[model samples]
Target chain A: MSNKTITIDDIEVPFEEGQTIMDAALAAEIYIPHLCHKPGLSPHGSCKLCTVDVDGRAVSACTLPAAEGQRIDNNTPALNEVRKTITQMLFIEGNHLCPSCEKSGDCTLQAMAYHLGMLDGHFPQFYPQRELDASHPTLVLDRDRCILCELCVRASREYDGKDVFAISGRNTNRQLIVNSATGRLADSDIETDDMAAHICPVGAILIKDHGYEIPIGRRTFDLHSVAESDLGEIKLSNVRHHDE
Target chain B: MSKLRVGTTSLAGCFGCHMSFLDMDERIVGLLEHIEFTRSPINDIKHCEPCDIGLIEGGLCNADNVHVLQEFRENCKILIAVGACAINGGVPAMRNHFTLKQCLEEAFIDGIGVDNPHIPNDVEIPLLLSKVHPIHEVVKVDYYLPGCPPPADAFVKILTDLLEGREPSLPNEMLHYD
Candidate 1:
């Protein structure tokens, strides 16, 4: 543990010598909204929800290490507006019909939208025809709900050692693909207990027959706002799964 | 002060949003003191006359929806899209993934419970649009209140703000999309 402190949004928080701004902020019980960042997994910085102002320049907090006396702006109207736009883009890129979604309350994407006060998609729907892969006996993969955060890809490779998932293609054609002979999850070696199965931050990867097990009003985000939840601790446990 | 005129409608949706508006409960009695309904399903008005604000509660799925929405935009000084359906096509736009013909045939000719099924071609029926569209896709929406139907509190807050001549900005707790 280090005794050094860095200022974030004018609040002083101690940081280890090599801790990133996001890591330090989390250590101090502060949350910088993020989707692609899971502690202990290598930082992807893909979502940019954790982007913050440091020394008057916007930087991704997950990858930007905090230095002594560093001043970071984690929450601002403009930064939140940017995050909302990103969240909106993610919603439109997929057919995120939140009302009918099984992950309506538990999904981090939905939680972040609520945290940022997002009221609409604010963008045109791409209406991309994505497939729902129910080939697996225990899991359902609905590409329509995927935000391509790569949490599953990282979890499968780093934790489960299965290397079962990887993102493929480029730009709008980008999609999550199963590493199997038939490109079906059932054909893969992933089991119901795999970390990849539970690591998805969206409704894209779901364990069959497990949906709505916790009713909508009783789910995580329903009981507490994302900011109110112990999201840092949640990510810490997700990363801790790698050790077990 | 002149009473603010409000008009509302639901299209291509479940009318759950209008129900949420009604969820304002006793507050509706208070709201009536400052506002008047002109062309809402709540009052069963056939057409919109000039109004101060128009609240639309669904997406566009047919020509009639578009016609009514456009009329709202033209007749009202401000138009608000009041739910997920009106904001981003909500559940109705789920059909955007399939071809219009596929949806029609599945509902008419090939559905499991359909009896002597055929696509309706009656001149009296409004033709279904090729795709469902949010209110903004057809006409400009001046404001949006997102939610499956934004919380009853959201309706009260926004309406109260507008009635008092302030721009409506929902507090985070009042703004939800589920």
Candidate 2:
């Protein structure tokens, strides 16, 4: 560990020389709400859920490098309110019917909303007519629930070494597209065991025949809040990796 | 103090929230000590009277639902949008992505095993809205209880808090979307 340190919400947090604010904060066991970020993946600050105030400037924590003596505000009420609104935007932007969704209890987006105490979708629902890709033999892509986090896009490209997914279009017209000739997941080279198959933070991409396997009350976010559960999973995975 | 008058209704919902409300079971005997039911299915009341609290389940999908919600909002001092449907246009809102004409066609004419193949457009039938809307979209909602059907303890907790003249706040455990 380097001697360099930064203060998040006035609490001293040590960081290595090259670590981003999110990296340093997570290492220090501080919970900063995020949706598009995963530890090993390259930071894509598209979601803006992890926006934090650094010396009165709001910036995405995942992309911002940690500097010495920086005063960063991670969990302020005003910032949380902004985050809540962003989460609501994500909800209304897509058809996130949490009650009927198979990913309800285990979805990061839903968990994040609950963690933020979001009671309703504050904006009008766009209710966009998106297509569902059930063409895959053992996987399904429901665009209705996608938040466009690009986690699967990064995971497939970086870890799986297959650029099977990419986002197409601009702004509201933007959509996730497949890399195959037919523009369907079944036509792509993706498999059930691929990192992209399991990397979605929302219910957009899901494995077939395994939905609702975990009972409602016993599911991931049901047992623990998103903050605790997400951090705990990361830490636990880190411990397992070290043992290996 | 007089018993607080309360009304409950289900529009396009399955009444699962009401089932969860009744899941309070014997505790409702305790609740009855403080509140009385009006314009609810429990009493088969057709119209809402002026009340202290009104708990509405389901979203507005038809003209009748809209009219009922507006009336319900008018009669209650504090209106609580109960369950996911009432709060965010839950499962029924899935139809929102398709045109009402397509939906009607699919359900009545195009769908398999439909012996009678015509969309209902009788005078007795309420007009279907182009989109399903959460209660708040149609009327002012004082509070929201979110869940597919919110848990029984959540209902009890919100009601208890409101009864004690406190702002209703649910614990993290009680707050869930499913």
Candidate 3:
């Protein structure tokens, strides 16, 4: 590992030669808010929540490989406001029913909103008539909750090697797709054990017959804020631990 | 000095937000000394009288909700959207994706466990709007206390601030969404 250091929010975090700013910051136990970028997955930089100021230029930390003596501003009031706008956009673009959503406290998106002081969905909701695909016996695919982070698509292709999911459409209409000819999760080779099924940061891909098992107050975010929780373990863990 | 008059009501909500206000517990008892209920569910008042503050819970899903919200906006000097529902339509707005007709059909006819399912055709029931709307959409909302139902402390904080003639602001811990 090359011992190159970059300053993020005035804190010096050392990075390997190939490490991105996000990777470096995360390695140093410094949290940068993100939804799309996950460890062990190639940084897609789709969410853009990890946008950081490198000197005067704004760049996605997940994709921006750290160079020696780089000055990166990961936390700023202006950047946080921009992030809050993006979070509001995400909420308005889809039908986000946090109260009724099974993801609720466990959802990374919800946690990010809480972290950023996004007190409300300030934008007018599009409330698109997204499809809910329950064709899969063990999982429910509710498109209303999909943020189109494409984590499942990446996880399925990268980790499980099944290529079971992909994202189609563009702009506000972009959506998750099943690999099967029928365009249903039931026909796809995505088992509940697959990384694709577990990597969903939202309520879009939920396991059937396993909701509300953990009550509201005692769920993941209830115990520990998302910033403090081990995000890698939360996203990647196949086992259901109460601490998760 | 006269006690501050406060009015409150639930529009298209599940009353969870009101429950949070009630969760203030002993704080409400303390608040009663400085505030008086002019028009509120707690006092069983129908028409909202002029008040210093109006704490509105829920979204505008139907005509009745809109009417009540408009009345609150007009009658109160400051109107506060007191939960996720009032602030941004919350759970009720989830039905915005579907037509109002479709929603009614599903609820009254198409949904499972239906025996004598006929759409209710009573004049007593107010009509649902084409889409659910947040309180701000219907009328200007002065403040928003966000949460599925903001924690009991959130109610206390806002009430305390307002009662003390200060701008209501949520502390980091009280600004929860779910």
Strongest candidate by DockQ: 2
Measured against the native two-chain assembly using Cα atoms, what DockQ does each of the candidate structures obtain, in the order listed?
0.72, 0.84, 0.68
Better-scoring candidate (lDDT), 2 or 3: 2
lDDT of 1 by residue, B23-125 (tens): 9999999999999999988989898899999999989999999998899999999999988888888899989989999999999999999998999999999
lDDT values, one for every candidate: 0.87, 0.90, 0.84
Residue range B94-131, candidate 3, lDDT tens digits = 78878888998999899999879999989999988899
Q: Regarding TM-score, does 2 or 3 come out ahead?
A: 2
lDDT of 2 by residue, B43-142 (tens): 8998899999999999999999999999999999999999999988999998998899999999999999999798877999999999999888878899
Query: Model 1: residues >4 Å from true position, as ranges?
Result: A230-235, A238-244
Instruction: Fill in the DockQ of model 3.
Output: 0.68
Taking chain A by itself, what TM-score does each prediction score? 0.94, 0.95, 0.94
Interface RMSD for candidate 2 relative to the native interface: 0.9
Candidate 2 residue pairs in backbone clash: none
Colliding pairs, model 1: none
Q: Name the top lDDT candidate.
A: 2
How far does residue A237 in candidate 3 sit from its true spot (Å)? Answer: 5.5
